[model samples]
Structure formats: structure tokens, C-alpha cells
Target chain A: MSPSVAYGTDIDERTKAAEQSATDVLTAPDIPWNLVIWNDPVNLMSYVSFVFQSYFGYSESKAHKLMMEVHKKGRSIVAHGSKEQVEQHAVAMHGYGLWATVEKAASGNETPGKGGRQRG
Target chain B: MAKAFKYGLKGISGYLEPAERDLLRGLLDDVISMLESDVRENEDPLAALIGLDMDVKQPGDRALLRLLPNVMKDDDGGSLEFRQLTERSVRESKIGALRAAALGLDKNELVLTPDDATRWSMALNDVRLVLAERLDIRDEADAEHIHSMQDWSQAEDVESYLALVYNFTTWLQESLVQAMMAARQAKS
Candidate 1:
């Protein structure tokens, strides 16, 4: 039998298309990334607030507020910037034992995700 | 990123059921003054007195809860340092726990078998050793790490330095309310 087509698309054409798409996505200009720290079961609320205040220079009350939001909600998007900055942030956060990741900022605005909406 | 909320409703009740709040207030000042700063004697000596069924309760049962906020207040009057200290400590403590758990999850993580506990304890000790030996005072990045709730970047010794200073203070309002209940009980 000749190359069978996939149910969702023509398999041979789709495979070629998928490869092109992946490359296009990779080569796309960096849209800037965000540093997201998720709430966890191990860290103390005080500590999370502390990280924001100490590392990022957030005020005590402000840090506490952000920390509370993270505790109450599931996660908090901490910082926003270039991919390298975000990746570095994620690494630092990980080193500090926090669960962190970097992702492209949501379109339309560059606001850091402050617990309002989940980052894409 | 792990949040360990040790107490809930039951823990709350045990914390504050009697006139225990007053006794707690007494014990807290004693612990804080003794550990962090000097305590001046109160004119009414009985005012700060905190007696308890379980002597270990300090003044009552939740002295840690009462001190959380004050601990958050920066000695330098800057909240930035205060928040940083708190976050760094928790991160250090949790990382310590994680390394232990990573080797093998605790009973809660996997199943707290007798075997698991032994292994976990050993792993914890190992992590402690690594932290103690590897503290690169010269490295700003390494200096930033807090291994045992202490912020060495600020003063000195990584464990007792600020942790003890701030240990008594936390944001455990619920825990304090529970302690207050106990204080009232003791008074009654």
C-alpha cells in the first residue's frame, strides 16, 4: 500500500507541513519570556514573599500581597523580560528550590502575570 | 514550592482553648528577648507570665504564630530585606527537605515506612553537610543561599543568626488566634 493518510490529515503532506511548522516556530523572533513561579506544598508563605522582596526589591507589604496571591491562587507569574533573563530567573528559582518556568508573554501587552491570568 | 501548612482546625483548637493567649504573650517576649534581643522586666511581673500544661508550649502552644508579623518587620525599617529573609529561609528549608525527599520520598511523599524514615534522616544529614561545607562566602550567588532559615548574607552564621531573630515571628495569624484562646482559658 502507498503511504496511508492520517485520519486528521494527509499523512505525508501533514508530516512535511509539521516539520516546516516546527522550524518556523523555532526561528520566530523571541517574543520575550516570563518567569512563572508556581505555588507549592513545601515553601512557607513568608519565604515566597521574601523571595519577591529580597530578590526583586518588592516592598514587604507588596511582597506579602503577591505571596498571598500565589498561596491563594495556584501560581504567580513573577517577572517578564527577554528569554535569557527569564531562563536565568527560572534557573535561579529552581536553584532556590522553587518550581519555575519561562514562556512567551501573552500577546497585546507585556504585563507580568501577577496571578490574574495563566501565562501561555 | 511546597507549602507545608502543619495545622488545621484541630491544631487550631489545641493551640488556643483556654486563657492561654496571655501566657503565650509572656513566653513570646521571654523567647524573643532571650533569643533575639534583651528583655526588660515588666513592673507587673505576672503580666507576662505564661504557664502551661505542656512546658514545651513555651507560653501556650503557638508562640511562633504570634511573632510572625513582627518578624516580617525589618530591623532596618525596610520591608525588602524582611521579605527576602523570609523567602530565602523557606527556600533553604524546603530545598533541604527536597534533597532528602528526592533521595526517597517521606512517608507522606511515598509511604512513611520505618525504612523510609531511616533513609530520609540520612539524606537530610547529607544535605546539611553539603550546605555547611559548600557555603562560598565570596560568591555573591552562593552567599545568597540560605541553608537553615538563616540569611548569612545579612549578618553571620547561616542558621541561628536571623532565623532565631525572626523565628518567633511569622504570618500565622490563625495559629495566633488559637493561642489567644488558650491564653483566655488560662486566665479563666
Candidate 2:
């Protein structure tokens, strides 16, 4: 039998699969999650930028750029980190009255149908 | 008077004259009453034992739903349960903030503890959300249209009036956030 196969029954295939899963878990930190803020009709652009600057410590210019992106693009990736970290961010944004969500960064490009009616 | 906010080691501070304060007080009170009236004691003795209440129906109002978002987008059952468990606390916190703001109105000066500052920020955002819904404010042009009309006397247009309130609340909320940020920056 090949070195890849263990002596026991179907355990060899199961072992390889488990090993692959373990490797994926070990590399998981590199696969970042994104905290996305969706535009709302109610939230002011200036207020959004201020929240970005206040909570995230982003500079004025950077915050403004992101705010504009959220306005024009309907959503913006505001932060990137592990799942727990991004979830915390999304909750905090919700607390600040902005619509927010977290998703795998690799899958961030998928845009769900917009929720609220569009504002200007 | 133009609304403004200031920050220091003493905490965040702002001024509102009697008329302005009254207007704000009324607005806060309105939202608080709306949120509070939604809750009622759980009638079932069995349910009461576990701290569950069926009286406060889940908020069917769009504005209320917006204020309380689901934790999980993928799981409908989980999200509904989460909202059921959390709706009361969220409404209470919102009411608490409005009351905190009301406390400062009589004095014409509002001073918030760091914690209260955060609450005020959140509460102000809620007020704006409610008003925005009423105004049908959908984007920059809508806001600008109202801004352009601010100088005119729109005595008949209820939306025009609500728009003014919305704009003022936005300024107030922005100032609070900026003040908090400045204080944080100073600490570092």
C-alpha cells in the first residue's frame, strides 16, 4: 500500500480528510472576514464618517472616502479581521445605528439584494 | 441657536436655549413614549417565572425593526428568537438615553458622562431614524431640497418641519460623536 494509506480499513481516506481540514483551520487566520456597512436613507454622510473615525480611529480623509463609497456603492467593506473581530465590529456599527454585517472576505463581492429603499 | 458640541476631561457638553431645549425634549419624549408603550407585563404566571413577556408584541413597525437588527442573517429562526429575547432591553436602553437627555433640558446645558455620551449618541441616531422615515428623506438631493427650503416659511408642510428636526438632530449627533473622538484623541 502507498504511504498515504493507513493499514486500517477506510480510515486512510478519513485521516487524509481530517488532516486537510486541520490544515485549513491552521491557515484560517489568513482568510480574513470583512465587516460591511450598508447605506441607509436615514444616516447622514457626515455622521457615518464621524463614526468611522471615532470608532475605528480612521483619519478624516480615509473615513470620508469610505463614507462616500458607502453612499455611492450602497455598501463598503469597513474592516477586515478574524470572524470574531469582524462580528464585534458589525455589532458596534449596528449600535451606532448603521446597518452592518460580516462575511468572509473572499466572498465579500457577492451583493445581496438591497434592503432599505434607496435615498439620494 | 446653531447646535454645537464641546468635549473636555469633564465629559461632553452642549448648550440649548429654552425654546430649542423644549423642542428637543418634546422629540425625545415622543420617541420614548412610543417605545415604552410597546411593552406590557407578561400576564401568564408560568411565563412570568422565566422573565418572558408575550404582552410586548414584537415590534411590527419598520422603524422599530430598523432600530433592532438581527444578529444572524442566515438563520431566520435564530434571528427571531434573538430579537424576542433582546427587544425589551434594547427599547429600555433607548428610553433611558432619551430620559438622560431630558434631564439636561431644564438647565439649558447638557453634560454627559462618558457612558451617557455614548447613550446620547445612540439615542440621537434613533430619533433621526424615526424622523427620516416620516420625511421620506432618501438621499443627498432630498436633504438638500429641504435645506434650500429652510429659509422659506413652509407653515403647511409637515415634512418640511420634520426635515428641519432631522437636520438639527443630525448636527447634534455629529457633534457628540466628534466631541467623543476629540476626547479620545486627547487621552492618547
Candidate 3:
């Protein structure tokens, strides 16, 4: 069978190109990463908010919002940037006694499939 | 009461009476000692406490794990490697911070410089971590258990005393953080 016949006739050129583009983007090494802070029982809520403010230079309101997000939602993407940037933020957060990790941010509507492991 | 925060342009100029200063100094001193011992243990777990017949167990040591958490939670090998690469520097930084805070305690009224504020933040956090681990404080209930048993007389169990310290440090750190944020806002 020909290459087109082997696949389905329903697959159009546009759909195939879109899929290829998505794969290329996702596979690229420069995907944006998120520095996530996880809520834990040990650290105080006020301390967590303070960390967000002092370290990230976030405004008080913004810091409080992120802190509450982490508190109520279990985790929050406190920062988003290149891998190194996010990793640095994660390390800084760790130094401040916050439970933090770095993970690749899922782009667009695409679900972050497997291997979405958190890194410190 | 918690440590009273006195914010200034330089940083928090918090006043600690002689007794308060002594209390903080004592706590930070303890933390410094704990961290120093941990460093020694890390170098050679068995040799570090050979005379004391103590074993330095990694990950299993609740206080050690809390103070220097595993960066990689899912992979044991990766976590071990991460600890190997970063734990020493982390421990040193924590020790440095604690020592700096200890220096501030010499004065009856401890004034934290901007840098000192940051150091105090980190140092106090470590103190809380160690206390949390020792208290087996997994949640609010665990903390409350200690709080409910508080006695001003030095007669109650040590857990109550430790709980008082933990709560006091939490407030101190919170106030320091607030002062820092306010200072940052003022600068901008």
C-alpha cells in the first residue's frame, strides 16, 4: 500500500502539518519551565507569602495571591521562564525552606503527557 | 508574644530584651551546632559519630530530611545525587545565616540589616524545620497537641517548650518577611 493508503484518507495535509508542528514545538529543548511551590504542613502561610515577595520581587498582593493558590490548590507556578531560570528559582525557594520544584510548563491546550516529573 | 518588628530603611530594627536576645541566641546557637554536626556526618557517616556511637542515616533522619529536603522526590538515585551535589553548600549557607543571626543577638536590641533580615529569614526557617521534625508535627493537629500542653513553669514536657519556640520563630519570620516586603515596596 502507498504511504497515504497505509494511513487513513480522513487525515488531511493541514492536520498532518499541524501535528508535525506541535511535535516539533513540544520536542524542542527550549520549552518554557515553571517553578512550582508546593504547600506543606511545616512552613507557615505567612512565611510562604513572604518568600514569594522577597525572592521574586512580587508585590504584596501578587505574593499573597500566589501563596493562597499554593495553599488552596496544593501548588502554584510561582515563576515561568527558561529551564535555568526556573531551576534557579526552585533552588532559591528551597533555601528559604519552601517546598519547590521545577517542571516544564504545558503549552496551550495540549495535556502534559507522561514524564511530567517535578525537579528541584 | 512574638518578636516585635521595628522596620527601618536599612531593614528591621527589632528590639529584643536581654532575655529575648538570649533566647534567640540560644536557639540559633543550637541550630548552628546541629548543622555543623550534620556537615561532619555527611563527610563520613560512620566516622562522624564514632566516639558517640551514633549513626547518621540519610533520608531516614527526619530532621535532616526536613532541613535538606530531597530535591528529586520520585527517583531515589537522582535524589541521592542531588543531595550529594548540593547538600553541603546548602548546609553551609544555612550555617552562615544562623551565625549571622547569632551575631545580631549580642546586642540587647537586635537590629537586622537588610542582609541580616534575609539571613534571619533563612536561619529561623531552619530552626522551625528541625523543631517540626522533632515534634513529629505532620499537621495542625500535631502542632496543636503540643500547644495544648503549654506551661509557663519549666515543669511541663520539653515538647511544649519546643512548641513555644516554634510558634515564636514563625511569628518572627513572618514579621521580618512583612518588613522586607514593605521595604521593597518603598524602594520601588
Highest TM-score: give the candidate number.
Answer: 3
Residue-by-residue lDDT tens digits, candidate 2, A1-120: 011234445878789888978986797668466778888767867678877766776666777888998999898877776666666665567667788766666654643221111111
lDDT, residue A81, candidate 2: 67
Give the runs in model 3 whose Cα sits over 4 Å from its true position.
Answer: A1-29, A81-83, A104-120, B1-3, B9-11, B40-58, B144-155
Task: List pairs with backbone clashes in candidate 3.
Answer: none
Where does model 3 sit among the CAPRI classes?
Answer: incorrect
lDDT per residue, candidate 3, A1-120, as tens digits? Answer: 011123355659668877978986786557566677787777878778777665665656877888888888787777766666666666677688788766667777223222222332
- The 10-residue segment of model 3 chain B with minimum total lDDT is B48-57
Q: lDDT tens string, model 1, B65-88?
A: 222222111232322333233423
**Retained native contacts per candidate, as fractions?**
0.00, 0.38, 0.45
Sorted by lDDT (best first), the order is: 2, 3, 1
Candidate DockQ values, in order, are 0.02, 0.19, 0.22
- Which candidate achieves the best DockQ against the true structure? 3
**Interface C-alpha RMSD, model 3:** 7.7
Q: lDDT per residue, candidate 3, B1-188, as tens digits?
A: 33567677546777667877778888888878876774443445543333221233355667866776765446556556555555666667788999988887876666666778888888888888888888888876786675565456743667777777777777777777777767665666
Count backbone clashes in candidate 1.
32
Residue A106, model 3: Cα distance from true site in angstroms: 5.4
